[model samples]
Target: MALRDFALLVLVCMLWAGNNIVSKYVVAYLHAPPLFYAAVRFGIVALAVFPWLRSPPRPLWRLLVVSVCMGAGSFAFMFIALKTASPSSAAIVSQLMVPTTTLLSFLLLGERLSARRLFGICLTLVGALAVMWDPAGFDFSGGLAFVLVSVVMGSLGAVLMKQMEGVQPLQFQAWVGWASAAVLIPASLVLEPGGFETVFSIGWRFWAAVTFSAVVVSVFGHTAYYFLIQRYEANLISPLTLMTPLATIGLGVAITNDPFDARMAFGAAVALVGVLIIAMRPNQAMLFLFNLRNRAR
Candidate 1:
């Protein structure tokens, strides 16, 4: 990656890290309804990017599926996890996305995985298990379980998205915003009664967080990321994006006062190393995303 691109990606990571802290605050501290928070966030994103919604991509069903998977499926579960999970732990667990994406490509896209990558996957799983270990009672963390589901959802969306063509970043965001809101709105109503009322009770603080997530994180940060990914190798980009989690860990400790003891630290290091190993090598799925624009032409 060029120095400039690296710097840009770093900024994107900072934005994402900050959003994670903001999300945890809203769901855990402010006691906002997780599903409702996600719904409103995406609803704001949909409105902000509505202009891009004009030119819908082809194979509309595929786009919609990708949107839901990446948007509502991942984020709703993540927010739910945040209701109990520390931002640091959630950030570490989300590294499972690297291994999960590779595995999904092997199963769904007939991609072959090398032995080294398989080891990386195994290591990542082990590290994730370690991070979620409740040493006190010898039980698993429920919050981390939801984070696992979120990772799988995001991984699936990324793999599916690699097969798509001619979808610009903002256009993709527009669809994701609309699709996620569509799913989350009704789901929130059914699952979290009076969610809107609770959110409304919070007033401007809720809107402020929603705006930051929608505009700063999704619109500016992610759109910038899409542009860079198109220009750079996925292997180069993937490892660098790990900065988001590291930054999240620091922010969580400082802001949220998360308990990141020795065990958690060791697990985070292991999980990140595994993710790094997976990211450093070329994979079919990453290649597909790198070549998406070329394939479209």
Candidate 2:
């Protein structure tokens, strides 16, 4: 990667990390309804990216499925989880996505994983569990459970996305934004009483948070990441994304004054190591697919 691209990647990670803090603040501290908050964010995104919505991608059904899984399903579960889970712990636990994606690829795509990758998956699971475990209560919290569900939704979307071709980042985001808003809006209205009222009462601060998340994090941050991944090797790009969690943890501790004990640190270290292993290993399927596309282009 060029020096400029590396810098861009770091900025993207920082923006994403800040988004975790912003989301936690919106849903937890501000007491905004999780689904409502997500709905509003995606609604803004849908409007912002509506230009790309004109030419629907082929196999519209698959696109819609992938959009819902990666969009509203993942965000709703994650925002709900954040109501109970600290940003630091949640960031560490979210590393499970790396392993979960690999496992899903093996099962759904019939992709084979090397022994090293299997070991990494096991380690990632153990580490995520460790973070979820509450020693005092002698049981895991529901927050991380919801997070696990969120990770699975996202992993499924990622696996399914491999079958999609010729979908630009903004176009995919447009679909996700519109589809997620469509689902989440009704879900929030029916499930969360007075959600709209509460959000409206919160005033401009609420809109500011939503705007930053929608425009900066969802649109710009994700679009920039897609740009980099297209230009570089997936393996090279994947490991660098670990910075997002680290930055999230740091921001959580500093901004939220989150409780981070020795156990939390250990879990984060272990999970990140596992994620690193999985990311560092070359992804033959991705490379082959991208190479073919690039040649055709």
Candidate 3:
């Protein structure tokens, strides 16, 4: 990746990391309904990008599926998870998106991972498991199951996204925001009573969270991410994006007062190293190994 592209991706990670904290605050602390908050956030995104929602792109059905998967399916599952799960735990579990995407790419897209990358994937999984080993609050529960499904939906959406052509991220998100709100607004009314009432009652903190997530994270951050997705192979992009979780961990500690123990630190280190390994091209990794051997000799 070019330096500029890498920097932009890092920016996306930061925005998304901040959203995890803010979204958790709204849902878990301020008692806003999860689905309702998501609906409003998408409402903001839909309005901002409504111009692009004109004619359907080339593949109408596939685009719709991608919209549903990336928008409503993933967002609903994540919001549900955030209802009970810690932000740090949610962030760490979400790194499964990397391995899930790579695996799907191998099966569906016929992409291949080098031996080193496979080991990196395994290492990252180990790190994630380590982080989840907390006895205090990290109990394996239904919330985690929702997050797992969320990762699967996101991974599948990204693979489908790679197959698409001539559809820019702006148009993609416009459709996502529009389609998701269409389904969720009604669903929120049916499933969770008092959703709109809660929205009206909540103050600036809620709106601030909604605006930051909708504008900064979803609109700009995900749009930038999808642009990269369209240009690169899924395996190449997915592992690098794991940087989001690491940033989330830090933000959780600072803002949410999440317990940051030694085990979490070690696990985070392992996961980040795994991400670097996967990010390195095969030849780059080979050269590093060769230099190491020469130094030892």
Candidate 4:
């Protein structure tokens, strides 16, 4: 890749990383309602991307399904998770989407997963469990379930996205933004009483968060990602993008002042290692040897 493109990739990662911190602050500090906040964020994105909605490449049904899964479904659960769970925890759990996507693709799309990938998936699941094993204040009752729901939805969306053809990234994003707004509006009103009024009364910090999510994270971050995906192979891109969760963890610690416990650190390391292995699709024997060497170091 060119230096310019590399720089752009870095910028995209930073935007995504910062989004974790923004989400935590918005839901926790600013007291934004998750569904309502997501609705507004996508509403703005819809408006911003409206012009590109003219000539969509994919079938309307497929596009709509993709939008529903990737936009409304993913954001709804993600916002709920961010509201209650620590940003670091949310970031780590979100990594489950990768393995989930792989498994789903094998089942639904008849895509083949190599033995190495399967092992990586197993490791990732184990790491996820380790991360979730916090004894002191682990609460899986409420919003965390929603986050897991989002992970499943996101995985489905990703697999479907691979089957889609001829859709430009911006066009796809436009569909996602508008469709998410459409679904989220009614859902927010029904699920969250007085949601519209609450959003209107929010302070500028909330608005800033909304703008960052809509413009910077959704627009710039996703756009850069699509650009990289277009330029490079999926395997190459996927491994590097794993850095997003790590970045989020760091940002969560710095911004939200979330505790950086050993469990979180160790689990994140393991999950990330597994993700890199799966994404890179290296030989299992080599990966095992490499892992052993790293441990010895």
Candidate 5:
């Protein structure tokens, strides 16, 4: 890769990593309601990207469906999980999306999976369980369920995004934001009492979180990701994103003083390894190993 591209890749990683730390602050200190916050964040995105929203190259309905799955479904569940699960745990569970997306593609899209990929998927599942197996943690069952749901929804969205054609990343992101906001608005109103009033009552900290979420995380971070995608293949991009979760775990430990137990460390390592295995194309992995051996020699 060129120096410029490498720098851009690093910048993308930093943006994604910062999102995890920001999410923790939003959920804990800002006291923002997850669904409501999502609604607001996407609302901003929709307006910001309004000019780019044109007739999608693909079927409009398909784009809308994927938008909901990727945007509303994923974000709603993820925010809920973040609220209850520790940041480190949430980060680790998010990696489950890689395996879930692979399995879903194999099932729904008739994508072929090799034996190694299958084994990697199993290992990912086991690692996810290990991450959430704390006996004394707060509501482990509920948190695990929520995080798993988020992973599934996010994975489905990702697979769907692959099937989609003709939508620019920004245009797709605009649709996702608006569609998610549309669904989340009503849900927030019904499920979260005093939703508007609560938002109005919150201090600047909450609004700061909202701004960061809308502008920095959603818009900037995703844009950087799309840029990388344009430059590189998905397999190369996805595995490098394993860094985001690892960064989140580190930030959670340093910033929030969250405990860094043996279980979490082991589980994260195992899960990340599984994710790498699943994401790395066979040829790419082989080449990588070959290069490593050559360098050693």
Candidate 6:
């Protein structure tokens, strides 16, 4: 990749990393109800992508299922986890998505994994769990469960997405944004009293955070990422995107005062390496050497 594009990828990583901290503030600090907050955020994305909502993407039912799973369901669980969990820990837990997707593929699609991938799966799961054993007040049992559920939802949604065709990134986001808003907005109204008032009373920081998440992260960030996905191998892109979790951990410590110790750091490192292993292409063992040769130029 050119230096300019590499820099762009890093910017996208930063935006995604910052969104975690920003969302924690919205739900935990501001006391915005998690479901309602997610509804509002998705609403913003829905409106932004409404143009693409005119014609339904093919395989409409599958798209709907994927939208609900990945959009409203996954995000609802994440925001709930964010309510009590440190963003750093929650971000670490979310790495389970890579393994979860692999497991799901094996079960649902009968995809066979290499021995290396099976080891990666076990390694990633154990390492992700290890982080929660923090002696600090960051209780993993509570928020960790929610994050795990979110991971499963996201992973399954991705598997379903592989069965899809002709669903561009914008079209997919439009479906997710609109479908999520449709479900979550109503659920929030019924379950969360004063949902509307909270929206009205929020400060500029609140809107800024929401805008950053909905626009910067969802819109520009994913679009640029998809652009790269088209240009490069997914394994190459996946390794680089690990920067998001690393950045999130730093921001969570710096901004949110998240507890971090040697054990947690080691566990995070192990888990990310596992993710890289799982995300590697079939020929990645050889390709890494090739990449090293290319990068030396």
Which candidate gets the maximum lDDT versus the true structure?
2
- TM-score per prediction, in order, is 0.91, 0.93, 0.85, 0.93, 0.92, 0.92
Clash number for every model?
0, 0, 0, 0, 0, 0
TM-score (C-alpha, index-matched) for candidate 3: 0.85
Residue 102 accuracy (lDDT) in model 1: 94
lDDT of each: 0.89, 0.90, 0.83, 0.83, 0.80, 0.88
Model 1 pairs whose backbones collide: none
Better structure of 2 and 5 per lDDT: 2
Better of 1 and 4 by TM-score: 4
Q: Which pairs of residues collide in candidate 5?
A: none
Return whichever of 1 and 3 wins on TM-score: 1
Any idea what lDDT model 5 has? Answer: 0.80
Which is better, 1 or 6, measured by lDDT?
1
Clashing pairs in 6: none
Residue 85: error of model 6 in Å?
0.4
Model 1 is weakest, by summed lDDT over 10 consecutive residues, at: 284-293
* Residue-level lDDT tens digits of model 4 in 1-297: 788887887788878888888887887777788888988899888888888888876578888998989999998889888777888888887788888999999998999898888987887887777777767655585366677899999999989888888888888889999999999989988889987677678778888889999998998789889889989888767777876787888888888887778888888888877777777746644766588899999
TM-score of candidate 6 on Cα atoms, chains taken together = 0.92
Taking the tens digit of each residue's C-alpha lDDT, what string does model 2 give over 1-297? Answer: 899999999999999999999999999989999999999999999999999998887899999999999999999999999998888888998899999999999999999898878877877878877787775752346488888889999999999999899999999999999999999999999999999789988888889999999999989999999999999998889989999999999999999998888878888988887787787755653554367579979
Badly placed stretches (over 4 Å) of model 6 are 134-138, 286-297
Per-residue CA lDDT of candidate 6, range 1-297, in tens? 888888989999998999999999998998888898898789999999889887776778999999999999899999999989889999998999999999899899889977888877887877787887655754556588899999999999999998888888898899999999999988998999887788668767677888888998998998899988888778778889999999999999999999998878887977887788788876875565467569979
- For residue 217, model 2's alpha carbon misses the true position, in angstroms, by 0.8
